[model samples]
Target: MTTTTAIGYENNLPTNDPASLIERTIDVPALGAHDLLVEVRAVSVNPVDVKLRAGAHAGGFRVLGFDAAGIVREVGDAVTLFAPGDEVFYAGSIDRPGTNQRLHGVDERIVGRKPRSLSFADAAALPLTAITAWETLFDRFALTPDDTGTLLVIGATGGVGSVMLQLAEALLPGVTVIATASDPERAAWVRELGAEHTVDHHGDLAAQVLSLAPGGVDWLFTAHSEGQIGLYSQIVRPFGQITAIDDGPRDIAPLKAKSITWHWKLMFTRPLHQTPDLIEQHRLLDTVAGLVDDSRLRTTTTRTLTPINAATLREAHELVETGRTLGKIVLHDGN
Candidate 1:
């Protein structure tokens, strides 16, 4: 029997208590035909990690982590994209056991070769946020280098925002990216990442955006659309597109008058639904790795905790729950 160290929880409890997570050895299941058994070297925490951890536990222990970079230790017979010894980065499928374990199995279709220029910890921070930002800008919103417009990004200093601003500057030429940051530090952070202007999200977001683009922004991407939907509707220009990566129950009725198109960017959709376009994730991740190597995209890893374990993971969760994390926090293998 093969087993690996993992951080898991049997109950959904507040991360503030520090006893919410536990460490244990878990069985590593045999791989499926298209699976790659990876030896996870580093893993990053996302809001989803916290959400899933806080949700009701379905049964036994639940391991929660999505972004990871590691070396391929074994591959199932049908796996062709990667093989033993290959280094890769990926956001694991939401329905499957997560990447919190030392050994994780993920479909090769959703994994990509890691950026050779980055360390395991840095690479681990890119996958989840990169996929979400890439999909939001290029796929959902369809921004192109040829198209010129203003892009308004709400919550522009966190993990996804850090990558989104960089991708916008790298992929969409002639576009002015305005990001909302509630503090001076975060504002400076977004500007460093390529945001042309920074507005306070806690203040009058619409007025601040209006001061920059009198007619309102041509496109908007927000991680807090549910709470800021009304503000979004007011600040996005007519016919503008909006992509929200945050979980929804967002009311789109306010968008009707402007004839705006609102879309959701769920990075895990391809893998979770087994969509035919699952390979697109692999292709985009590959492109992201290339961009990273080219210095066109920067890793958002702001902090790393050593010796991946329950205490460290719980600490990461606490940071995430603060809702003020500037970038991604990663956990590196103790060994």
Candidate 2:
């Protein structure tokens, strides 16, 4: 109905370019049926944000962000899950204008109550990565609370893996979590997040993994499938499973020998397709919030920038592009 300030890009450009992201005045998004109009308080930057910002949007401009924490301002006629004063968190669908704006309209089915124990900035860091890890475990891998096995997580210090390690420890106490961290600092970080063992992904993956588990792992979660698919096949046990979020052509021929099942995840699939079960995201986020409140899980936010402006978002994108951030980076609305 009105307008609000937002950070967005008109043309795809390098993160360092002055025009890559800019402040613009946009219409305060109108609510759709089943949508919650949220006054976004904090947002987090993700690798997907960087990737999408590097590509052109169909409309020649796009707001870019997914993970966010906010307070509900209004709700669509079809929305029954939330109210005007509720605090919420969610990872937005790729098909929509993102969370970078002050006011955002998101489907209530995909949003959840923010963790009451966390600051908005910290809560903002959980949504996107949390959903990716949650879907991979409960949906793709079919991991259960009673299952007992060794799980190998490559790139374990980033947002998704960091949260995954915690989830595994809490939800599948019988399943051991072995995480890959290239350096001792990262190793310590993973350990703090509940990783039972640490291996260097830069080293001999097979040797390290086999040393930890003689028969190799029962499940593998990787962020660089294209680079390590063959190695994964070697270190995962017969009939083991793998779920990857990497982007590239993966030669799965190596997996057939051991019958290792390789599954890919995007986290956006449910929301993009408007799948009937997409509300599972809401349930997952609520579960994560409960864990956070219970101290069984922790926010992966490692950095918090202020003001939620174009300059800060640019810096956040640059940090993500480095591919070395330990956890998530969040931006506050500076309220």
Candidate 3:
């Protein structure tokens, strides 16, 4: 591949419009001093991508994607973390154009070495989900790697929840992990990922959780309905932390009464705002890579699509929108 041959989807109209599927040829910006020009091998679709595309302001022929694994084709003068020909993977900044293309210009601070044990498609599934799970557990909840308290993972079969289950199981040894999945297959899936117990979210969550722990759960990680905040409060012990990745219009007063600590995990906030600690994403991703390469953790890519294009991307988006995907869905460059 030259400095080009990039393939990606471009939406010129609102996502609700029928003509939003337009595709075109364009040049990615040259590498900045702190950037890496990556030859994208695989990309993953997340729910945020679908939500953003469906919004009214989805314009400017925007390139929309986040998770990607690829080869570093060129490095800027200031880049030191990676070199040309290095293999890398990352969940690109939401504020920047994304990695849906064959070529992507990425900031070095947000990228990490791809796990040596995983394929490009597998590695592509990890970055976004891993970042969310890590930030939610370690950053937002302030849970240490060795904390052995019982953690209740609501909706633990979804993308972020799947990785969260693995991270907790791998890093927090002896910690009782109670995961919630609505169906039998999803419940089994979470168990296979190392969850100690799985409960049905459609049932009484507090009762089911109590049946397992007897004492209320010490920590709660919710990847599902924000409307269930009250349910979380009932299941978490007083002074316990409850972190969620869901955006809410629901009341958290139930948590207030229980003295439950509430935290919202938005993985894109740091990169989107360019916060002072934005470099932490890079550090976390690097740590995750180490875990992957060492075989302590696994990539979550569950589905793959051939050739990156608009129609294929639409299919991936539709699957995510269905709310039943077991892990990550990826699209490779058809190499």
Best lDDT goes to which candidate?
2
Please list the C-alpha lDDT of all candidates, in the order they appear: 0.90, 0.91, 0.82
Regions more than 4 Å wrong, model 2? none
Please write out the lDDT profile of model 1 over residues 300-329, one tens digit for every residue.
989999988888999999999999999899
Question: Which 10-residue window of candidate 2 scores lowest in summed lDDT?
Answer: 52-61
Q: RMSD in Å for candidate 3, one decimal?
A: 2.4
RMSD of each: 1.3, 1.1, 2.4
Best-to-worst order by lDDT is 2, 1, 3
Task: Write down the worst ten-residue block by lDDT for model 1.
Answer: 243-252
Pairs that clash in candidate 3? none
Cα RMSD for predicted model 2: 1.1
| Candidate 2: Cα lDDT at 91 | 98
Report the number of backbone clashes for model 2: 0
Per-residue accuracy of model 3 over 37-91 as CA lDDT, tens digit each: 9888999999888777766364556777899999998889999899989999999
Off by over 4 Å in 1: none
Instruction: Please provide, for model 2 over 1-335, each residue's C-alpha lDDT reduced to its tens digit, 9 standing for 90 to 100.
Output: 59987788988888889899998898988788999999999999999899888875637668989989999999999998999999999999999999999999899999999999998999999999999999999999999999999999988999999999999988998899999999989999999999999999788889989999999899999887776767877899999999889884546788898998888899999999999998999998999999999999999989999989999999999999999999999999663
Clashes of 3: 0
Best by TM-score: 2
